[model samples]
Target: MYIPSPFRDDDLENMRATIRCARLANLITATSGGPLATPLPLLLDESEGEHGTLYGHLAKRNPQWRIATIGDAMAIFTGPEAYVTPSWYSSKRQAEHVVPTWNYIAVHAHGPIEFFDDPDRLLEIVTRLTNIHETSRATPWAVSDAPVDFIAAQLREIVGVRIPITRVESKRKMSQNRPMPDRIGVATGLAASKLARDQEVAPLILVQD
Candidate 1:
């Protein structure tokens, strides 16, 4: 996360928002063998620890959980992202220097990685995670919907993860480095893009002022 001063997002609330909106995250760990990474749907517990805690699980057979991490693990969460073309810059017409870049939001959370197999804690984490994602559905599902034996059998196949965040680096690169005219040009160009992510990024670029 090489964030320039202009693009750094230091606001705690904003950082939390980005994490919450990110449904999936890449969990990376350094091991004696090599680096291992897994993509998982994670839940952030902002109430825990100074920064926060991340909760997720991996398949019981996944080797990543077996290896001991040398240091803190990193959870990478990415928000809306779009490619920005130099043609969108007003400087293009003035023969001024301009190059293509990307506009996006990302958060990197680093913390000590803890793996657990306690069924109670696993059930709590899984239940909360399921509720969070299913709340928007007309027929929201719950862990209690399944029989106790069935749920216990399913839980046996997974292991729980708890990462107490020690550091968080957030970046929101939404054309904040560009001049007003260039930003407007970018917004206009992105708004017209056929990609939904580009359209979503267009407003963020325009709202930065």
Candidate 2:
């Protein structure tokens, strides 16, 4: 990723936060045939490695895992992203020098990829993944809520995935490079947008001079 200095994010905790908030990740691997990718939910275990470890699963039928991976795998997590119009920059009105750009948050985790099918490991991964999402529900569900045999049968159809993240790169491009007036204008413009993603980005770049 070609991250400009203003957009680079190096804080480990912040990067982890971005990963945790991301609903899904693209698991990509370089293969002899070609690069294969899978969109899946991944759990980050912050304590497992120097950076962290990722846990997820793919359907047994997914061929991406069946191929021989050449080297490191990469998991991409993207957060709130929105198109910024030139109209939002106060400087645009001054000299017409400003152009449109994007404001977004992204994190890339790179490491070795491991695939496993052990029923017990698969069961644990699914159960943990389920709890992470379900705990926020008003009426939360649990793996134990289903029949033991049914859960086991379902686990048999998927392969567990683990990646110990060795390197990570993160970027937070939220108009931080813009002057105070321009950034304020951007925040106000985004806040007025009806799109939820735009609204989410409003406060990220919001600052008081």
Candidate 3:
């Protein structure tokens, strides 16, 4: 992540918040075949290590788990992102130098990757993951919702992942580089947008006030 000084986010809590909100992550690893990436839901355990630990699973048939990874694995998490038009920048009218850019939040975690197929651990990981995503629903589902034998059989088809995070890089590119007037223009413009992502980005920009 190329983060300018203005957009750099070093706050651990903020980075964790972004990861939590972004349920899914792009897990990438360098392999002999080339680079492989998989999109999966990862749970971050902030108390684990210097940075944190990531937990997730991949389908047993996914060759990524069986491949020999050369170096550290990277997990990318992205929050709300929106296209910012030149019309949203007040500077566009003043100097016409401002073009278009994007406003978004992203976090990257790097660490050695480990894959395991221990049934007990896999069971616990599956249970926790299920609860995290379903807890908000009226009829929340659980691993126990299904028969014990059925859940055990299902777990056999997946491999567990554990990455003890060594470092984290985060960026909150919400037009912090723009002047107050330009930022206000962006906030107002995004707030009025019919696109849900654009509207979600509005509050983040407004907080810069």
Candidate 4:
């Protein structure tokens, strides 16, 4: 990610929070054949390694897991994002110098990729992942909810992934480069947008008083 100093998010805790909030991540790997990417719901274990560890799984038949990856892989987590129009910039009329841009948050985690087929480890990862997403539900579900034979049969169709994070790059382009008035204008414009995603991203770029 090409993040300017003003848009760089170096706070480790904030970066981790963004990762946790992102329900899905894009896993990218460089292979001898070419580059392959898969979207997956990944779990971050912050206590595991220097940076952290990522856990997820792929379908057993997915060729991505069979390909060889060089060195490390990347997991991309994306947060709220919105389009900023030139009309929202105070500088637009100053000298016709303003152009459109985007505001968003993203985190990239780099780590050594490891794939496993151990049923026990697979069961553990699946259980933890299920719990993480289901905890907020009124009727929470668990992997153990199913019969043991059924669960084992399901696990046979998937392959587990573990990546020990070596580095994390976070970027938050939230109009920090704009002046106060311009930022405020952007927030106002976005807040009025009909799109729910725009409304969600608007407050993220609000200028501090």
Q: What is the C-alpha lDDT of each candidate?
A: 0.93, 0.93, 0.92, 0.91
lDDT of 3 by residue, 81-166 (tens): 99988898878877877789999999999999999999999999998889999999999988898999998898899999999999
Superposition error at 10 for model 4 (Å): 0.9
Question: What is the TM-score of candidate 1?
Answer: 0.97
| TM-score attained by model 4 | 0.96
lDDT of 2 by residue, 1-209 (tens): 88989899998998999999999999999998889999999999988999989999999999998999999999999999999998988888778887899999999999999999999899889989999999999999999999999998998899999999999999899998999888988999999999999999999997421
lDDT of 3 at 4: 88
Off by over 4 Å in 1: none
Residue 135 CA error for candidate 2 (Å)?
0.3
* All models, RMSD in angstroms: 1.0, 1.4, 1.0, 1.4
Judged by TM-score relative to the true structure, which candidate is superior, 1 or 4? 1
Q: Which pairs of residues collide in model 2?
A: none
> What's model 2's overall lDDT?
0.93
Residue-wise lDDT of candidate 1 within 36-151, one digit each (tens)? 99999999999998888999999999999999898999999999999999999988999868889999999999999999999999999999999999999999999999999999
TM value for model 3: 0.97
Candidate 4's displacement at residue 25, Å, is 0.5
Q: Candidates' TM-scores?
A: 0.97, 0.97, 0.97, 0.96
